[model samples]
Target chain A: MTSLPTHTEKKLGLAIDLDTCVGCQACVTACKGWNDQGYGAPLSDQDPYGAAPSGAFLNRVHSYEITPDQGAAVIVNFPRSCLHCEDAPCVPVCPTGASYKRVEDGIVLVNEDACIGCGLCAWACPYGAREMDGDVGVMKKCTLCVDRIYNEHLPEEDRVPACVRTCPTGARHFGDFADPDSTVSQLAKQRGGYDLMPDLGTRPTNKYLPPRRKDAPDMSAPLAPLLDIQATGFAGWLDKVLGKI
Target chain B: MHPAPSVIVFTVLSGMGFGLLAFLGAGLPAPSGWAAFFHWGLGYSLAVGGLLASTFHLGNPQRFLRAFTQWRSSWLSREAIASVACLLALAPVALSNWLGFGWPRALGLIGAVLALATIFCTAMIYAQLKTIPRWNHWTTPALFVAFAGAGGAILAGQSGAGAVMSALLLALLLAAFRIGDGAFAARAQTLGTATGLGTIGPVQGTVRVFEQPHTSPNYLMREMIYLVARKHVQKLRSVTLIGAGIAPALLLPLTPPSLLGFAVIALVHLTGAFAARWLFFAQAEHVVGLYYGQR
Candidate 1:
C-alpha cells in the first residue's frame, strides 16, 4: 500500500469580501514592495520614466462599471492574483521540479536554483498568476509571503501575508480552510463566497464574496425646475449658441 | 503554453528519432553492414538525447521516478512511462545486433511499438490540455503521428530503397493532414464569440489594453499569444509542404538507386518538419489569452 501523510491534509486559504473592498490598491503596492525586497531579485523596470514602462507585480486591480436598470452606478473593482490552489496546475507541469506545491502547507513555490528559465509553469497556469522575472530568467508568483507567515519574530496579528495585512478595508482574511471554525471559513459560509473560474477545476483556495446591493433609490420622481439658462454672462452666450434651455 | 525550447527540441528530435526507428522496424528493408548499424545507432541516440534534454525541464530530477506513478490522470506521466519502455525495448535490439547473437527482428518490433506509443503519449500531453483549445483538438495527435512518419521517411530515404516509398507516402499524408487542419481551424469562429460578448460579428469597440490585470506580463499572455500573422503562416506552410513533403516525394522517384536519393529526402524532410513543428506551437491559441483583453 502507498503511504501518504495524513497530517498534511489541512489547507490554508483566503476569503476576499468584494462588498467591503474600497479598491484602494494598497494591497497591490504592498505586495510589490514586499516581494521586490524578499526571496527573488527586485522587480526591475526597463524604463522608469519612459513611454513604454513595464515591470513585474504580483497583484492588480481591475475596475468594471455595471449599470443596472433600477439602481445607481455600481462600480466593481476586482483585485486579481494567484489563488494558491489545492491542485495547482502550474506546479507539476514544470519540466524542472522548480515549480512544486508544498505537501506540508499547500503553498506552491518555485525553486529558482533548479529553474532553467524554461517558462513552462507560466504556460500551465490559467489564472495568469506566474510571471517570468526577466532579470533572473526564473518564474515568480505570490509566495503568500511564506517567509513572514512562519517567522517567529513577528506577532500573531502581523503574521499573515503582506497583502492581507496591508488591506485597509478588512476585505481580505486568511486562515486554515480545513478548520471549520476559522474566520475565513465562517465568513465564506455566511456570505456565500465563490471561486473565480470554478469551471477550470483548479480548486483554488481563495474565494470572492459577490457584490451585494441594498434597496434601489426611486428614479421615477419628478425632477425639480431647471437652473436659469442665462445665470452667468458666458453660460448665457454658450447656452444660446448650443440651443440649451 | 510558454513552449519551452528544451521541450520543443526534445519532442521534435525524438519525434524524428523514434519515428525513424519505428518505420524501419515496421518491416521496411534494413541497410546491410556498418551503414545499417550507424542508422539505428544514430536514431536511438537522438531519441535518448531528446529524452535526457526533457529532464532539464523538471524541477526535482531525483523525484522523476515519481512521474510514472500518475499515468492514470496525467499524459505527461504516461509519456515518461512509455519513453522508458521504448528505451528498455531498444536495449535488447542493440545488444543482439552488437553481440552477433541473431537478427533481433522481434526485439526491433517491440522497440518500434514502444516508440510509437511514446510518440502518441507525447502528442496526448498537448491534446489533453483543455486550456489550449487549438491544441486540444484531434488534429494535435494526427499532427504528431504525421510528423513522426515524415521524419522516419526522411531517415529511410537517406539509408536505402527500403524506406523511400514509405517515407514519401508518410510525408504526403502529413502534408495533407496539416493543410486540412490549418484550414479548418482558421474557419472555426467558436473562440470569437465564446466569451458571451455577442455573435461572430466584427469587433466594434476600440479594443485597446486600457489596464492590465498586472503591471508585469503574466504567464497567460506569454504562453497563448500565438503571435504569428496569416501571411507568415502561409509562407511557412508552403515552405514546409515543399521541403518536408513535395521535395521528398519528387526526390524519392528521381535519384539513382543507392542511398543518394534517401539522403537528400531525409535532409529536406528534417528541416521541413522542424519548420512545421515550430509553426504548430507558434499558431496555437489558449483560452486564457481572452482574459488578457486580446481578441
Candidate 2:
C-alpha cells in the first residue's frame, strides 16, 4: 500500500511566486487557522506558553538573504510544506500504510489511523514536509486542503487551499498541473519555476518561481563625488589647511 | 538525528542480539539444555527488549501491528517480518536442543541467514535517507554489520574470529570517518539550493538566513538539526575505537576461555558499540537542516 501510483488523474499542486511574496506569513497563519478546525487531527502545540515551545505546523515561512549575481541581498520568504512529489520518497518509506499519494489528485496525505508514528516518512522526505504530531502520535503533512478543494457546501471561489485563498499578495496559486495549460503550469513555465533540490529527484509537483534579481546599486558610485569634491569656497580653504595636516 | 536513547538501545542491543543469533544458529560452541537456555534467552531478551524500546519514540505505539502490512515496499516493514521469521525459525532449534530431541542444524542454518538479513534491513533504514548525507552511504550498513559481526562473534565465544573482526571493524571505522567527515560538504547543498536561490544566484556568493520561521525552535529543527558538541564526539570516537575495536582484538585472544571472560569482553564491546551508534546519530547532518541555517 505504500507503493506510489505511477499516474494521478489530476496533479493538483501549488506554484509559489517568490517575486511577489512579501513575507507577510498570512498564508502560514491562514493555513494553521483553517487546519486547526478541519481535516484529521488538530495541529497540536506542545508547551504553548512555556519557554521552549514547539508545535506541528503543515506550512511554515522561512526567510533568506540571498546575494544574486546582479543584485543586493534579496530577502526571499520561502514557504515550506509537503511538495506532493511525483516520485514521493516519503510514501514507500512508511512502515505502516499511513503515507500515500492520492491517485485522484497528486496530494500526499497521512492516514492517522494507520500511522505507527515511527517518523521514518518524515526522515525520508527531503523538503521537511512531514512533521510528527507529538500529541496524536501520528505523522501529519500538508494535505493541500483535500477537505476544502471539492467541498460542495463551500462557495465556489473559496474552495482552494487555505494558504492559496488567504495569500494577500497572491504568492500562492493552486490548479491542476496535469493539464499543461492550467494557470499554475503556465505561471511556472513563464517564470522559470523550479523544483527544490531537483537533484534529489523527487519530481516535486509544486514549483517555486525564483526571486527575480534586481540590479545592485554600486556602492562606490554614490560616494565618489563626496570623497573627491572640488574645493572652491572659504570652506574649501579650510579643507586646504586640513590637507597640510 | 536527535540520537534518541530508545533508538540507540534498539540498534545496539538488537544488532548484537541478532548477531549472536547468527553465530548461535551456525552451531558455534553448540550448547544444549540449560546452557542453550541461557544463551538463546539472552539473545531473545536483548532482541525483543530492543524491539520494545523502539516503540517509545513512536506517536502511535498502539498501531504498530499495522507496520507488518507494507513489507513489499517498506524496508522497515521488511525488517519487522524478517526479525520475527528469524526468531521463529530458530525457535524449533532452541526447543529441540533444550529438550534433547534434536539439533535441527538445517533449520538453524536458515535462521542464521535470516538473522544477518534482519541486521541488513535495519541498516538499510538509515542508509536510504538521502536527506541525511552523513548516513546516506554504503558505509552506514557496512559499519552496522561490522559492529554486529564483531560483537556477535565475541558473545558466541569465538575469540579467534572475534579478534579478526574487531581489527577489521577498526579499519572500517577509520575509513568511515575519513569519508563521512566531508559527506555533508560533498553533497554541496547550501541554503541557496534549499531555498531555490541557486538558480538566480549561480555565482554562489552568500545566501545567509536573514530570519528564521519562528523565534523558538520548531519540531523539524529539534528533531533533525541536533548539533552535538564536537569535542565530546571526538573523545567518544576514541573511546569507541579503543573499547570496541582495539581492546577486543588484543584482549579477547589473551583472555582465558571462560563464560565470565567472554562476557567481560562482550560487555566492553557492546558499550563501545553504544558510543559508536550514539555518535552515528548525533553527528549526522540532515539536509533539512540547511533550511534552518544549520550544517
- Each model's RMSD to truth, in Å? 7.0, 3.6
Tell me the tens digit of each residue's lDDT in model 1 across B1-295. 4456777788888988888788656545465556668877877877888888887765345556655665645567678888888878776665555555566588778888988889998988777665565666666777677677767766755434324444553555455446545542463433222221122112111122334555555444655675645348777776777776667666666666556666666777777776677766776666566555552
TM-score of 2: 0.94
DockQ of 1: 0.14
lDDT of each: 0.67, 0.88
Give candidate 2's whole-model lDDT: 0.88
What count of clashes does model 2 give?
1
Candidate 2, residue B87: the lDDT equals 94
lDDT (Cα, tens digit) per residue for candidate 1, span A122-240: 66666667777756666778888888888889898888999899999998898877788989888888887676655556788887766666565565653633543245688767867
Report the TM-score of chain B alone for all candidates.
0.80, 0.97
